[model samples]
Target: MQKLKSKANAKANANVKNSAITTNKRLYTERQKSHFLVHSVACLGTEVHLAACPLEFNKGNSSTGACEDGMPAVVSCVAGPLYTHNVALKKKLKVSKNVRLKGGTHTAEGRVEVMRGGKWGTVCDDRWNLQSASVVCRELGFGSAKEALTGARMGQGVGPIHMNEVQCTGQERSIWSCHYKNITEEDCMHTEDASVRCNTPYMGYEKTVRIGGGRSRYEGRVEVLQALPNGTQRWGLLCGDGWSTKEAMVVCRQLGLGYANHGLKETWYWDSSNVTDMVWSGVKCTGSEMSLTQCQRHKVFNCQKAVARFSAGVICSETASDLVLNATLVQQSVYIEDRPLHMLYCAAEEDCLSKTAAQANWPYGHRRLLRFSSQIHNVGRADFRPKLGRHSWVWHACHGHYHSMDIFTHYDILSVNGTKMAEGHKASFCLEDSECQEGISKRYECANFGEQGITVGCWDLYRHDIDCQWIDITDVKPGNYILQVVINPNQEVSEMDYTNNAMKCSCKYDGHRIWVHNCHIGDAFSDEVERKFEKYPGQFNNQIMN
Candidate 1:
């Protein structure tokens, strides 16, 4: 057994030595000329002579007369992996995660950053070119760099400038792996931050799919160009029955947008184009398809309610916003208020009140308002901007600010079994910074016509006492109920996660006093916990007050 083990170890050592020798030979051969000529000599009938072979001749040299006695014909051959080029295996280059891009609209474009000493720092744009930029793009899961931007086109970066004069072969896995000079403080500034825009695969559907008759490029009625039997292309509408975010994802991807925010069905306001013919229907997608054509579609067109008004629409975004509710604020700020009918005229006109409020006698009824402070935080990489353009924003004289979107939040009172009894919706929320992280500043505001949006790292606060912030639960009988508040409810805007957009609380309303408890983020709990929370009987008896 000892002899066998010794023999195996010796074999392993020999193999290792052979590998090293082969590698050294390969390196040496790679330094030589790429091509050479081969010459051969043979003895024919006792007469030694040079055989004819492909060779480069010197000036005025005769091939036959060049051969002399005692003079040998020299032959040179190319070496290295090229000698066995047909069977040579390509070795994979090592990849590292020390390089990154930041603060661009998409992952494909950003300011380059390198990790060192457990901290990330910027790369100087000095001597930066496409080759070096491509290395960074490839490291970040993209194709080659389409543009290597200088002078901090992605905005000035913060931190130590770590690299300068970077030289890459466009084959490196990380930007730090390339040859670069160690940058000094005086050598670079934040204004010199290097940035890159990477090339991505063309899905070839951009011309075939488009959004028309909308305020912004991101928001519009979806129109697709279909080829006719005679090889002519015509634009037409798509049926909206099974159209959803999954299908919209493909449409956005085809249009070079990052993702789908909302797949709208009834784009009545965007029907100015008047293309009323439905060309496609029953489109279904898994959300990972590269284009809409790759998704499943019905072979035969069958539209139940086919019309231009009911056609599909989409809102695409480069980076989706993540709207997270402040559960603690909702629990602590729960209150009830009595608002007279005359005070809710604006809310009624905007359809913010519940359906039952429409039947109330003029100026004679009061609404039982269950109001709570809603603090929505934009915890995404991008800011949450409204789908509408500035020109389309309605300036509400009552609220004293231009409303970007028509509806933003949904407040609903539900039964213990999940049936909605009464609901209220907040329209045209003027997005502004309520608070921010320690280093971040407020970037948006509602005053003086400032740009309105929930900036990244900022929160928009809606106080409990605000108008139309309460669910009109006057017609709802006193019983065990669930209070649900959903931000971006209709998915009119794109978000990182729709599951976390809802907040739920257990409630017991006894016609006069209301108790709200167990308030939590809808998606924060596990499936088992959610089941338990949904089925748990409240403290109030299961009796409906007439």
Candidate 2:
């Protein structure tokens, strides 16, 4: 009897193990993979990429299955979601108009209303623009219209149209009459049925409006919290706090997140371990717009599993602000005259407009005053020398300027790399500006031939034909050679492109050192050769003189 009981017990144990293993597999697998069921309006060329069988939302595949057309699905495969949820969803829309109005005229306020029972009703011209028109046309699913008519809606009750002046600068129009001025003979535009016909060439971005609201939290322990406009509080870990603006910042030097205040834009540090198996739960802000946190939450077991899978957790929370960064500033003024040099937030004692002296014609040099309005945030570093290019320094300067100024911060030749190279020498260079005092890292770029084939401005480190070429310095004895590195970034490279693919050159020697004149590298150019990889794009050329 004891022997028999032992055998039964072993069989039961095996069954339990099998059940546990199967349950674990299900928990880690993507729950909603490969389930497409969209049936709203779709036009030609509207792409529908399929997801692989084992694929799932956020998680990869559970089981492989043949498509209706009989094809195998695989992981990381180009096919889209294997299963789709809420495919029946559609988008809401609105109408807009771009009628030309006289600059100073109040009657040209771009707007119109519908006429109900001969009574004209005006719309509250809110968030009006071409994009709004695009949505309306897409929703209607008609070929999208060229223009969203305003002001010409069926005339609303003839008296003073409350906000009648529909101000618009018909972007592509040539005629003054193209946009409805206070009074234009163009009768085709009636002031009643403010209509938007669907005349779009194709359908894309139709889902922009359909996106609901919510907040997204990063994977980390909540260290600080701030009350957002709505009832919910915005939370963040030991990194920072407040809405996208400069609310607050936290740092634990031990975690490699050192203390820095000015440029909170690039700072990111999180502890992924604290994240529970949570689906993106959307939190409701005052506006109807849904933030990342506003999304629905995940199941309990799934959340725990997710947290466990990532030993070092990383969480991302949503913010309302979309930040603009690393913008290039070019100097528009050519002549250098004495003028008021100003910075943002400068104390009155330091807030004086720079004045320039008059030319030879004046009895005495007349002073021209330039008022300094605010203190400039120069938060970047400059690179003096780099290898792989003719010896030169690449200087880069960056900072956040005041919002109101139409003015821009540009590169002023503090001093050129005047290694005394004659006009038109074939050499590549790199340069940068820095914010070491502000705790920000180094930022610079190389100069080489660019897309248009000019050997001008910063050249990406790759593509030798356009990058730094080692100079033949044997014959040209080295003394204190004066060289100049100029920087002008090509607008073509985007932020992502710079981070992922741009090239950079670094060197061996740094700071000030002395050497005898004519002491140079044999097969070399500049005796100093330092090398470092740069992952950011810059606004100028990279050149160095050893």
Candidate 3:
């Protein structure tokens, strides 16, 4: 028994030594090149960018190579654990590229969705073939397409249906360059959208990363298997110092999760996992990276709060809600109403009308109000909830309603040159589920302080008769104008996409009557098609205005 125990101990020591050698080799290998290039200079103390660094690449001053090859003459300000906190507070995150694949259990396969003209939409499967599918897969960094599916095999997508009848020859680098047939209303539908399964290389990223303790598979405390200097592996906790949506995005992509819904800085509730070792800290992602290993990290564990309760965490989801205003209703609801000042005490108190309304006689002079109805539709896979909780809600005594958000929508009238002619009044909403689709029960109600949110397949209708729902246009001279209404314009809430939130209409208003036409969502048409909009026969000389 003593001889057997001695042999087992020797084998374990050998395994640790082998792993240590591999780690040393990785310091100078191509793996390190992927994370960073040994530039002559990195971050400077006061300078936010490396370009402003005093070091130059010219001549004998610099020796550039891997970490083990040579030491840099100028030390990077972000080099060691001492400066990780500074970088966390100073490093600016890059804007996220607006693209995602949805309805799949894994990241490498899904119904292809693209963001063009500010909205997320699916590709039509009309001519969907392997050639086109391969381009999409290659663009996502997966090698190629294993299978190209048609007729919404992965499930249908919401918002505008895009990229119909794609024609590719299999060598194109990106799906954007491929030829596609322009879709018509009767030609295609979301039910006939395209989906693909990509030929992804088995990376085995799941072996190193895991969600520590959570109720669901999609959410938990983030823990990673870290290698010790002696080359043994143990599950370690992540510091919550700078974790955010961008870092969560990389984690989700690495785990084959669909998308990141939230990034939790402190996860005390999910601390059920007994991991107390803080092995990673100051993970700064550029919002475009596909994995956490690709991001910048501290050389040592440098956490301000090393408690396990302060570990980084993430909540992921397969889908997000997409909101769109009913453009047809907005156009059809256009009419002029001369509202009496005597009956607008609630409106005046709430600051719903124009600023000039305050100077006018209270019971005499009326204001010309441009009335329109806005129906915000949630067409995506998840319900749309307010960013703040019930405690932050403000109650308006005059309207007798609670405003969940300060400004839910933006209504404006712009000229053909994109100049604002008349600014529309902002309406803070109580946000109730006015109605829902078949088999979908309402989750929010305005009565008795019910929960506030716009459930999926439901809409919150702001009728024309409601207070603070009209535009004060008494001083405006009517001509050719663009009516633009943007839902969630301030982006106070999270959603699947924000580009399709804007709806535009062409309005021709004379002295007596008004005409609103050509209304459509912002992403409804091509740029070329939209450029030809609201163009009167000879409007450059103001013939229509006269």
TM-score of each: 0.52, 0.19, 0.57
- Clashes (candidate 1): 1
**Residue 245: error of model 3 in Å?**
6.2
How high a TM-score does candidate 3 get? 0.57
Task: Please give the lDDT score at residue 214 for candidate 2.
Answer: 11
Which runs in model 1 stand beyond 4 Å of their true positions? 1-246, 253-257, 261-279, 282-299, 302-317, 358-365, 537-546
Q: Candidate 3 at residue 375, lDDT?
A: 88
lDDT of 1 at 405: 86
| Ranking of candidates on lDDT, top first | 1, 3, 2
Backbone clashes per model, in order? Answer: 1, 128, 0
For candidate 2, write residues 1-546 as lDDT tens digits: 999999999999999999999975765464334442321222232211122122323222322332323222224411111111233422122212222121000111222333222223333232334434333333333322345554332111112222223333323222122232232323222223233433422222122111011122322332323345688854332222211211111111112121111112122243233323223211212211112222232332232222322211222221111001111111111111232213211211221111111112333332221111111121111122221232222222222111111111111111123222221111222223222223344344222321111111112221212211111121232223322112212211111011111111221111222121111111112112211111111212133211
lDDT of each: 0.74, 0.24, 0.73
Q: Which residue ranges in model 3 land beyond 4 Å of their true spot?
A: 1-132, 135-142, 146-192, 197-257, 263-314, 417-419, 425-430, 437-441, 531-546
- The lDDT, on a scale of 0 to 1, for candidate 1 is 0.74
